[model samples]
Structure formats: C-alpha cells, structure tokens
Target: MTDTDWGELAQHWLDRLADCSVPGAGVTRLPFTPEHRRALGVLTELMEEAGLVVRLDAAGTLIGRLGGPESAPALLMGSHQDSVREGGAYDGIMGVVLPVLALMKLRHDEVTLPFAVEVLAFADEEGVRFPSALMGPRALAGTFDMATLDLHDSDGITLRRAMEEFGLNPDSLPDLKRNPTQVLGWVEIHLEQGPVLESAGLNIGIVTGICGIERHMVTLTGKAAHAGTVPMHLRNDALAGAAELTLATETLAHETDGLLATVGALHVRPGVVNAVPGEVSLTLEIRALNDALRECAGAAITHTARDIATRRGLSLDIARTYAQGATTCSSKSIEHLCKAVATGSRSEVRRLVSGATHDTSAMAELCSVGMVFTACRDGISHHPSELVSEKAMTAGIQTLEQYLIQLQ
Candidate 1:
C-alpha cells in the first residue's frame, strides 16, 4: 500500500473511534467502560482485517499477533486505548493504529520478518478511572498489585468489579504475565505530545528516556470558623495553607530545571460561601527525566507543605500514592529506531527525553523498549486541540514499517 493508502486508513480508524466519544467534547474512553469496549472492538476488527490474529487478555489489553519463526522471541509494539476524561483522540490511539497499518503495508508487499510482532492496545494507561496509571502494561509485566482490586471509581465501581463486568476475571490476570525470554523488546509509535519535534523542524523523534513520576495526596486541616467573623491574624485556614503550598510547588519546579510539578485536583470543605474552609485536599504530581531531580523536587515540595501548615497552625498530612523511576530506552533498540528514521527521512533523527510517561515505561520492566514520536500541533496533548498532520502520520508509518523490516 502507498502512503496515501495508509494515511487514509489511519484517518478512517481514528474517525470510527471518534464516534464513541462525547460529541464536541474530547475522547473519554475510560477503562472497561462501554465506550472503551466499543473502541476496542473497532480496533480488533481493523487488526484482523490487517491479517493479524487478535485476542484480549485478562486485563482487557488487546493483542494482535503476526507470526515469525517458531521459538523466536516476539517484538511488541502499540500503546494504550483508554484516555483521560475528555482527552484528545491521537495521544494513545496513534501508537496502536500506526503499527497495525505498518503490518498491513508489509503484508500487502508480501514481506515477512523472522521475529514475531505483537500490537498491544493497553487498557488503562491514563489511569482516569483507576487511581494509578500503566495498569494494563503493569499487569502484563506481573507487577500489578492485587490490592488495587478494591480501588473504587467515582461511580463506586471497584477495579475487580469493573474487570468482571467487562468480561475479564481479575483472578486470571496472573495468566497474562509475559515470559521475559519470549519477548525481544517493545517499540511504541506515539505522538510527541509536545512541541520539541516541531520546534526542531522534524517529523519524528526517537525517545531517549521517559520521565520519572511521583504522585502524592496532601491534606491540610484546621478549625472551621465563620468567614465574616474570623480575623485575618487569628484565623487558621486550611485553604490558605494549601494555596501557599501550591504556589511553592510551582516556584520550586520553575527554579529546578527539567522538573514539573502540578496540583491538578483540589477540594475544600465545608465548601460553603460563608465558612472558612476547615480542610483542603489536593493532589501533587512531580515529574522529571532525572530520578535525582524528581526526588529532590518531591522532597522540596513536601518540606514546603509542612512549613506552610505550621505557619498557619494547620495540620498537614502527605500520602504518597505512586512512584515510578525514570526509564531509558535500550541502546540496541535506539540504534534500530535511528536507522529506521534515517532510511525514511532526509532530516536528522533527533533524540529527546519524554516529559510525559507512556506504557513503554512499564514495559521497560519486561524487555528492552524504544519509542518513536510524531510531531503534534504545538505542544498540546491530553486536550481537544491535540493533533498531527497527515504528512507527519505518513512519515511515522514509513519509519515504523522500515523499522519492522529491519527486525527480520
């Protein structure tokens, strides 16, 4: 198939899934939801039509396989299917579609590789429904904590219940663990999700590493008082303390190079217009390509929160919810990706550190992994405005197809 043919196919698949999302809003295919299942069904059909054998794992991860020599370790590719609430369509979907189309193009050309290739559409990389990210890949890596089965969503649905409702048995998740020796490596073709590639005037980027992430839940408590009666000097306000800590987080991240800290969620109570907030709860997320930097930032933020609470006479508590170390792509896989980009484009293939985490970060625990990033419009991602040009998509597919051929 020609580039035009592949581009049209990609657009067709994207548009098909687009209907599963809320109209005029961004994509919201949360894990195990009806929309997510519908999207997976569409993708499964497309994969089968591409001449791949398709199956669904116990964790609801979709896998499409192409054969190689018997006893040869297979190469894994693709990304997650679930999106953050009202998120863009291309963030995770592009990774899955590109590989399927690349394989289809290979089949059309009658080319066969010596190593098997498996396309993975992970179930819950966004963690929008669950409290943690990378759930799907973590399950396959045998790192999924069974305790998370009790974790509840906004609708009061436990992860285990959600799995069962979606036709997956949580007890069977252990069976999905992949044998390390049976998998050669993983390669994900994702959108850059940032403007680095576009700024560098390149159509694609080879990811050097994924950022480490630390997530925390912070709560500040104080005595509730009447808003009008409480004197500024006498008041102990949890909301005020939280605000100070939030600004401190932003300041520290700005002062520290390559560190990013965000207070994405906040809640205040008694949540009344006439009452001074007695408690404030917020989520803190720290990320950096360097592990040391990430740790330092987390420590600094924690210290700042404590200091703010002490000054305000409010009690402070911090609970770490998640922590993931930085991950570097394997050297051999990087070499293969670079060669693929060189063969497909005249522009220099740039190596970049991803500020955002991906399913490949979890897969790195199972086997060697690498990633290719197509430039997205501006630096936008996880939003409705996220997009990639048709030309860039075509380039990504060509590069991926060439990379797969090199694996033979």
Candidate 2:
C-alpha cells in the first residue's frame, strides 16, 4: 500500500526479467517466443493483481487498463519486453515495470485518474529477431505493414509466419492501428542507455525527440585469386575494398557533428584462408537527431565507398536497409513530465534526444508523446552489465506517477 511496496513490485518484475528465457542470455526475453509469452503472461497476472483489466492484441502487444472518467482520453505508458541476445536486465523492461508500479502506487493512494491509464508491454522493440526495430509500437501506430511482416528472421521464417505460429493474425494487423482520437498521449520511462545522465550526475532525462536512422548494406565485388600466387600490389581483393570503404565511413561520420556510423556485420565469399575474397558484404548504420544531417552523412559515406571501390578495381552496390525519420515529442507533454520530475525531486530535468529508436517515434505521428529516462550504469545498455540502482528506479517511478496523476 506504500511506495516501498511499489518498489518491491518493481523488483519482482526485475526478477522475472532475469529468469525469462527468450534468447541466449539469462536476461533476454525475446518477442514472440514461448518464453516471451510466458513473461507476458506473468505481466498480465501482475497487472490484474494491481486491479487493471488485461488484454493481448492480435499483434501480441499486451495492454492493461485502469478506467477513469469518460470525458478524458487514455494516458498511455509502457515499453518493450523483448531483449537483445545476452542483453542487460533493464533496457526495455525498466519502461514496463516502472509504469505498472506507478499505477499500483496510485491505486494504493485511492487515487482515480481523470482519464484512463493503459500500460503496454510491447512485444518487440529490440529488433533482435527481425532486424527492423519498433514492432509493437509500429503495429499500434499502423506504421508496420505487410511488407514488414514478409521479412525473414534468422531462422528463415517470415515475420508473418512467426506471428501465425504464435497465434497472432498478421492479416488483421491494420486493425491494430490506433485512432489518434482515442488516445491522449504516450510516455515511456526507459534507461538512458548512454552516459550523459550518469556523467552529468543526474537521475532522470527528458527526451526531446527520437533520432532518424539510415541503415545500408554495401557489397564489393572483385576477382578472387590464389593467395600465394597473387601479390597484394597486383591483386584486386573485394575484402580490401570493403575495408577501405568501412574506414572511410567511420572517418566521415566522425567529421560530421552529431553523426554516428558503425559497421556491425560483415561476410566474405569463399571464406577460406588460402583464397582472396571475390565478394564482401557489410552493413552500415548511421543515425542522428537531424534528418538532413543524417542524409548528408550517409551520402558522404556512399561517395567514399564508390571512390574506394573504383580505385581498388571493384564494383560496389549499396542498398538501404531502412531509414526512419526523426520525430519530436509533443512540447505540452514534455512540460508535464518535467514539472512532475521537478516537483517529485529537486533534480533539474534537461531536454535530451534519443540516439536510438523507440515505439514512441511511431506514436508521435498520431498523438502527443514523451519519455522519461533513468540513469544507466556508465550509460551502457543492451548488454549484461546494463544496470540502474534501486534508488534511481524509485525516483523515476515517483516522478512518472506524479506526471500520470497530474495528467488527470
């Protein structure tokens, strides 16, 4: 009935995160897997225990509702439950637990919101399965389409097929899209997943916008040769061309302010020790809060790749994986969240932008959206070491609770 009890509830969710087996890690709870469903089942039980009505949609997004006055639209809060392989316990799960606990705290206070409050346990935000992020929110926003479902996972099963196996109807996905008129606003309490808050000695961060992402796959083609027979000076190696282009991208991204680029995956044809590679493929991900800046940065990288390939006597092919435009949160909702934080704690809340993608980006197109961030240990996330202290999590919950109640 007290805040301590709500804190305890948060801890219970943390424990579930540790035990849920969705992927390779003890902490990861991947979406659509049996383990993921089991975790969602546990979440349903918790929400029901807290007096919320629970339902799982056709796309597997779990919703918990606390009804309020009929005149006000719903106050929505929640985060994804899926985790990256071998990822940390907090990442997406923190967003899920805090809001639920905050709702519990409110109910204990005998407080009824002026508007209904719904907590969502998003099925997939990590994109660890399909490589396209923000699945749950996309479905809710009507942004995720059949083309998205047609993509194959690592196991060669299309996303639609996987959804069918999990008892979700992919064909009815359009129905899952939310009507902006039914929802008032969205707020997500997530770990910062970066060092800014911790390094600044801050407890919470208010997100301003979600950054745009430009993902591309680059392929280099050249003549393969016997390693012993062809000298480096005479041979045209696709792998070498790829290496040059990768470094060029890195250098250009660094030169551009606020730009981030990474070559995360790579493969070489005829992967043998004795043969020079005839073909090389690599993936590049570039992101920034400014879409124009991101586009310029991407173009620079592409130009560099072409120049490097030409000099190396290799052919280059580049294709976009996905490009998400930057999205800004509603200013009114942000003011509410900041005021709540300031009232709940003495800490000064600063406006920050999310370097990563979230479901809120999708929701922003349709309704007012905002975010709350707790300090991640060393700003590290998506790994086993990602952590946030109990005190910090409690602070975040209190602030979010105040925000939700004030929204009434």
Candidate 3:
C-alpha cells in the first residue's frame, strides 16, 4: 500500500519541520514557543489531509483518530515532533511522521481496522522547558499531576503556564489520561540513536526494553594551597582524586559487562592556572538493562571513588540525584511487530534492547509498549551530523503499516 507515494509524504513532513526555523536551521520549538505552535499546526493539517479526524487533548497532545468497530480497544501509534535545540531531523519528527504516512497509505488502499487507531504527535518529550522529561505521556498516564506541573524551568516558567499558553489546562489533564483497559498497545518508531543496526547491516530493530538510568554527583574535598609552595607528596588535591575516580568508573563498567557509565560533567572550584584546587564535583551517569547489574555497577563506582580519595588525603561525598527503573517491552507486542516487519520486507528481523530512555517508558505504565528503530549512520544521534538511510525509513514505514493492520 505504501509502495509509490510514501516517500513524498515523508519529504513533505521533513520540509515542514525544516521550514519552521530562522535563517539558521535551529529548532527552538520549546513548549509554549511560537515555533512550537507553528510546527503543531503543520502536523494537524497533515493529519486532516490523511483523512483522520484530529483533536488536541487537554495537555496539548495532537491526536488523530481513525474509527473502527466499537468493541475493541484502540491501537495507538506515533511519537513526538518537538526537537532539542538544533537536534537532528529524525529524532522526534520521523517517529511521528512515518506512522502517519503508514496510516495514510492504508487509507489510500481502503484498508480498515477491526479496532480504532489514534496517531499521537506528543509535545515536550524532551523536557526542554523543564528538567523532567516525557511530559506528554506522563500526563496521559495520569502520572503527571498538578504537583509536577508546578515545577519551573531555568527561567522560572512553570509547566502550568506553558500549558496555558498552548491552550491547555493542567488541572483538567487527568481526564485525558487513557484508561488502561481502553488501550490495546503503544508503539514508537524512532532512530536507533546508536550504531548497532548500521554496524549489523540491519534495516530495523524491534525494541525489547528501555534501559534504566542512575544519575549521581560526586564531590571531593581537600585543602587549597599554593601550587609552587606545596610539595607533591604533602599536597592534597581534589582534582587528582576526581581524575582517579573518573578512570575507575570506566573500569567498573567494563567489569560489569552490560553496564554503561560516564562522568560527563565536572567542576573544579577556583579553576586557575596555578593553584591547588580545594574542591571538585562531577556527575556520574550509569545505565543497564537489568536492575541488579545497575546497582552493582553503581556500588563499584562509588567504592572506587572513596578508595582513591582516601589514598590521596581527600574526603569523598556522593549524592544520588535521580534514578529510573528499567522498562521492558511486552513480549506479545514485540512478536507482533516482528511479524509485521517480516511480512512487509521479508527480511530477517533483529530483536534488541534500547540503551537510551524514551517516552515509551511512561506509556508502558498504562499499556504494553514497543518501538522500532531505523539505523543512524555511525551509531550517532542528537547531533547535526546525524544521518539515517532513506531505504531504512521506507522499510520502517512499511513495517508500521503492516503492524497496524495486524493489530486488528
């Protein structure tokens, strides 16, 4: 059904996203911004053109409805369109556009469903305005209440105010959360955001789970002294302790096999050319597919940091900032997706786990959730140099269309 004209649809949406920008191609479409509204308008028009009755939920989530028999729960598909500042073309836009294109192709072929289908173009999944991510799905799951909305961004802009600017109400959002029994399943088509698919020569991957995340902040304290006066053995340096801890984190991850850890941020108090630093702070991020391994890896990292500090005459402090449990995709939903891909392309399919977090984790709280990933060249994403093969995009659309048909 999507053979000839689907590429045209993809190009149309890609152009739409590209056009809603300044002279430079930066997508500053943060929630409540003028750019965000224009992008949503384009999405609404496209949904209507594809013959779906569309509406915006109380949380400003764009919904497109294709009606069917009244008995079965609806099968939901699609993703977000908002991008991080200057993010790649595919990250959020393709996820929503490809599914819509698939549905449009099905409609063109006169294909109907035994159950209703709704395509969602969620807003603010990146949490650009706030530190908390997955705003749209959290509200839909009834997990984000007024209390969460009360939190403010760096500019002191509350989510409630942001929602109001976009014509939504924070208090009335509970009504928009889907009843668990009313949703058959949820699916998001996204870029792999990594190199696995491209390296393995695969067209797509059926996601089995989204990894858990552990964010920590570590501080090392020592006496500040003149660099030239303090002898090497007598001097206690916080930066030295921090450097040893950073190296230990890498070793810990390798020891745990599946564990992934990084010290992405660091700050040395009184950053100067000729001074012994008195304090050092760094952020530690750890991820794993399994909870037990995640915890064990974290312990190893902390222990190593402490040992290094003790030997160097510095004191260590570690604080837990945030932690999210791992989320697994439903086996039944994954099998269904696998079959859909096989039917569409007749190619061998790969089942993989996502190393990155997504809005799918929030949806999984209310319904079975699965994802499809088109490869990004060199396994890179969230950057301007990001790339995805046109062929993989086409195959991804075909797989989604077939998946929707089988959902009946």
Candidate 4:
C-alpha cells in the first residue's frame, strides 16, 4: 500500500468506530461498556487483517503484535480505546488507528523492524467511569493499586465487580504487569487537542512534555431558606459561594502562564426554583507543565474558595481526588520523532507541552516515551465538532511510518 492508502485506511477506521456513538452526539465509549466492547472487537479484527497477532491483557487492554527478533524488546504504539463522555472522535482513537495503519503499510511493503511492534488499545484512559485514569497503562507499569478495585462508580458498582460482570478477572491484573526491560520504547500519535499547531499553520509537531494534573472535589455548606422570604443580603447561599470560587479559579488560571483550571461539574442541593441552595459540590482541576506552578495554582484556588465560603457564612471542604506529575519525553525518542516529521513534511518541527493528560504519561514509567501531534481543526476536542484535516492525518501517518522504519 502507498502512503495515501495508509491515510485512507486511518480515516476508514475512524469512521467505523464513530458509528458506535449516539447519532448527532459525540463518542461515548466508556470502559467495559457495550459500545466499548464492540469497538474493541472491530479493532481486533482490523489488527488481524493487518497481519498482526492480537490478544487481550488482564486489564482488557488490546494488544496487536508484529513480530521481530526474539532477543529484542518490543516497541509499543497506539493509545486508549475509551474516551470521556461526549468526547470527540480523534482524541484517543487517532493515536490507535494511525499506528495500526502504519503497521499495515509496513506489512504490505514486507518490512520488519528490529524490535517487535505492539499496537495497544488501552482500556480506560479517560477515567470517566472510574476515579483514576491510566488504568491499563498503570497495570502494565505495575503501579495499579489493588485498593482501587473497591472504588465505586456513580451506580455504586465497584471496579472489581464491574470487571467481573464484563468477564475479566481483576485478580489476574498483577500477572499482566510488564517488566521494564520488555519494552524498547513507546510512541503515540495524537491530535494536538489545542490550536497551537493550527495557529502556526503547521500539520504536525513533536510533544515536549505532558503537564501535571491535580483534581479535587470541593463542597460548600450553608443554611437553606425560602428564596422569596430571605433577603439577598441575609441569605447564606452555598451556590453563590461556589459561583464566586469558580470565577476566581478562572481568573487565577488566566493570570498564570501555561496554567489551566476548570470547574466542570457542579451540584446544588435542593435544586428548586424557590429554595436557596443549602449545599454545593463541584469538581476542580488544575494542569501545568511545572509541578510547582500546578501546586501553587491549586493552593491559591483552595484558599480563595475558603475565603469565599467564610465571608458568605458557609463552610468549606476540599478533597484531593487525583494527582499525576509532569512527564518529559526521552531525549532520544524526541530526536527520532523530529527526524520522522522532517522526512514526512516540509513544515518545521515544533515542540510544545500538552495541557491534556495521555496514557503516555503513565507509560513513561515503564519505558522511554515520545509523542507526535497532528493539528486539530481549532484546538477543539472533547466535543462533537472536533476535527483534523485529511492533510494533517496523512502527515501523521507518514511520520509514524518513517519513525517505525527508522527504528529497524
């Protein structure tokens, strides 16, 4: 197959997986769900068609392997199969589909690399159903905590129970851990998910590092009162306090360079038209390429929320739900990615930090990791409108093909 054929194949698979979503809505393939299972089955078939041997690890991560020398460690590629609720088509899926296309092209050309190539469709990278992200990569890295198995979802279904219902054995997760020496390196091709590349009028770029992320669940408590009876000055409104904190968080993130803060989920108790809110619960997240910057921003947000609650005659509480450190790509891997981009396009290779987290952030713990970024339409993702041009997709596939061939 030619380079154009690879791009067409990538688009074909993307369109296929997209059919699993609700009509007019974005993709919603959460881990272990029926849609997710169907997507995996389709992907497995594609892997087999591409001349790769496919299997599932204990965590349900799909692995499609292309053989190489027996003595060399394998090179890992691909990304997660699952996505956040209403996520765009290209977020995680592009990383998986593009590499598989590249592998298929290599097979068509009768070329084999020095190290084995394994295309991985990680089970849960969005963590929408679970409290933690990187479940599959964490398992491969041997960093998954057994206690997390007891964690419950909104429906009160424990992780272990959900796995069992899905026909997986949680007890066997430990046995699937990959030795550090078993992987030569890992490479992922993902959409920029931001406008950096598009703004620069570039088709592809190299990732410098992934930002640190911190998540929190915050609550404000106040006395409930009749909306009509209570004067605005006399009301102790938890929702009001929460609103002020949310704006404060936005301001803090804006003032700090490269910092991103979002209050995505909010809940108000006694959600009635005539009742003053007695309690408010919200989720806050902070992302920064620097650990110190991330921590400082998080602390400032918490402090501002506390002050708002106190002045509003409400009580405040904050619970940290998740934390992951910033990760830099290996220097050698970056060099290879740069060379790969140079071979595929005339565009200058650029480097930028990713504000969004990826499974590669966790895989960095297991082996050397690198990332290639294709430009999205408007740096828009996690929404139905997310898009990348065919030109960009072609550039990405060509770059990936060059990178894998060079590794041989």
* Candidate 4 TM-score to native: 0.88
Best by TM-score: 3
TM-score of 2: 0.90
- Backbone clash numbers for all candidates listed: 0, 2, 2, 1
Q: Which residue pairs in candidate 1 collide?
A: none
- Tens-digit lDDT string for candidate 2 (281-302): 9999999999999998888888
Per-residue lDDT of model 1, residues 150-225, tens digit only = 9999889999999999999889877788999999899998999888899988998899999999999999999899
Could you estimate the TM-score for every candidate?
A: 0.89, 0.90, 0.96, 0.88
Q: Name the Cα RMSD for model 2.
A: 2.6
Ten-residue stretch with the least lDDT total in model 1: 15-24
Candidate 2 ranges beyond 4 A from true positions: 1-8, 22-24, 130-133, 147-169, 226-232, 269-278
Q: State the lDDT of candidate 3 residue by residue for 241-294, as single tens digits.
A: 898888888887877777899999999987898999989999999998898889
lDDT, candidate 4, 1-408, per-residue tens:
555666677878888998766556888888877887888888988889988899988788899998878777899998998877888888898898888888877777777788888999998888899886788898988898999899888999998988888889999998878887888889998999989999999999999899999999999999899999999999999999999999999998888999999999999999899999999999999999899999999888888988998899999999889888999899999998999899878679999898888989999989999998999998999988899787788899889888988887
What is the alpha-carbon lDDT of model 4 when measured against the actual structure?
A: 0.88
Q: How close is candidate 3 to the true structure, as a TM-score?
A: 0.96
Q: State, as a TM-score between 0 and 1, how close model 1 is to the true structure.
A: 0.89
